[model samples]
Target: MTNMTFSEQIWYGLFKPSKYKELVESRKSRSVLYILVILLVLGLVTFVVPTAAIITGFGGMNKLFSETMAPVAYDGNQLTIEEPFRMNVADTVFILDSTYYTVPDKELERDGTYIAVGSKNVRMTTIIGGEKWMDNITPIEQVLAPGFSNDSLVDMVPAIYVSLFLCYLIMCLLYFVKYGFLALILSFIINSMNKQMEIGLSFGQVYMVCFYGMSLGMLLTNFNIAMGLISPMLVSTVTVFVSMNFITMAMVSMRKGNQV
Candidate 1:
């Protein structure tokens, strides 16, 4: 059995696929479990820096709402604002104009105004992967809670943060499921390949190989998310490519009886 620590194993896993033969031969399923747990923890920790940046940036949001936003009132029937509010960020626009109940499709497409609030109702457009979604309209009464007012806007920031934290947890759970499923599929493929080559790898051993091979991909995915550097689809595509490449290299090394 190899005397490598978990951290050393991870390093070798990324930079030295030939080392996988020795790692697999070690038969330390407990080490594999430790690696999986460490990966999950690292995934969650990746959000901390970005979350801190967002929290620090809330000062600007507070200023925007407190200073730029006019006092607004939403009665049971109609919504009223003293003045229109507009802000544009990159490809997205936010608008609060009480005159028009609905925005024209042509204008929305041209201006990329995904959110528009008016007197009677609020119209929202969602776009994903360059596809424009249908507009969702909600009556003003339904949009605003009974006690919602301009004065309470700042107070709601904490609740929004709480909701975001909850969303992060949900995302982590989904990622865990996705990672496990992908590893299982890869293990199956590797095991079948090994059978044809007479390498005689068990499912458990192949699974451990997949777990280690996918580490770099998981790190890249989390880094992309924290940086917001690419689209979600692009991130997923890159992750799969990187992971498969590493797995292939590791399996090849195993077949050749390579070691660190």
Candidate 2:
């Protein structure tokens, strides 16, 4: 096999349909290097935008909590928090069963962590990290921001990085399996088309083509997601269509070359 750099390989994968012939020729000589690199790149590119948005939101919330979460008031088994209540990363809000102005028990229950008390669900619930944390509180409630402290916020920096990295790695493996399955289905179409044109690919060759095809589709789908042009529900179908289109274009190019 030739010592093709990743950049050169990417150029071929993205732009030059004819170059897939070389990929097919060298397919048997392949190692895990290409798969690992491509999967890593795909996972990172797909996740980076959403992850950045999440981090930016967390930073904004941290700043808001630091600035506004002061002047907490406590009454006998009841706490009255000021507006701008920070939900995630803090458990500073509380609900009292006796108070007429009850806390957001239902909303917090739906979106966060909360403890339901009794059959009526009327109880003091604390929200932490966007989850309902504790239900049925005592009267001596301290609305202190325990986990939302500056130090704790700082700790999340490395935690977020590690989590995202692990998630990306897992996603890469899932994508590998998912695309492999889709390629197996697509290979039948490829075989029939190639037979008509007197030029065809093995199932393995089609699988590799689908893999490369999916790389471009992933980039495109992530771009669309980042730009809000499409919802995540459309991701699978869009990716399949894009991969099929890439393979079709490559096949057409190859057929034209054979005729010439």
lDDT tens string, model 1, 50-118?
Answer: 555644564555665676689777766776778887655433456777766655454465533277888
TM-score of each: 0.65, 0.58
How far off is residue 183 in model 2, in Å?
A: 2.1
Give a tens-digit lDDT track for model 2, residues 1-260.
Answer: 47676678777776566667666657454524566776676666666555566547757535533553443343334434444233332112223222333344454644433432221223456455566556664323333332323344444656656765776777789777876676677777787887797766676776666666666776676667545676766875877687777787777767776410
Among residues 3 or more apart in sequence or in different chains, the pairs in candidate 2 whose N, CA or C atoms overlap within 3 Å are 77-139, 112-130, 112-131, 112-132, 113-131, 113-132, 113-133, 114-132
- Worst lDDT window (10 residues) for model 1? 104-113
> Candidates' lDDT values, in order?
0.69, 0.57
- List the candidate 2 regions with Cα displacement exceeding 4 Å: 1-3, 27-32, 53-157, 195-200, 230-242, 252-260
Q: What lDDT does candidate 2 reach at residue 161? A: 64
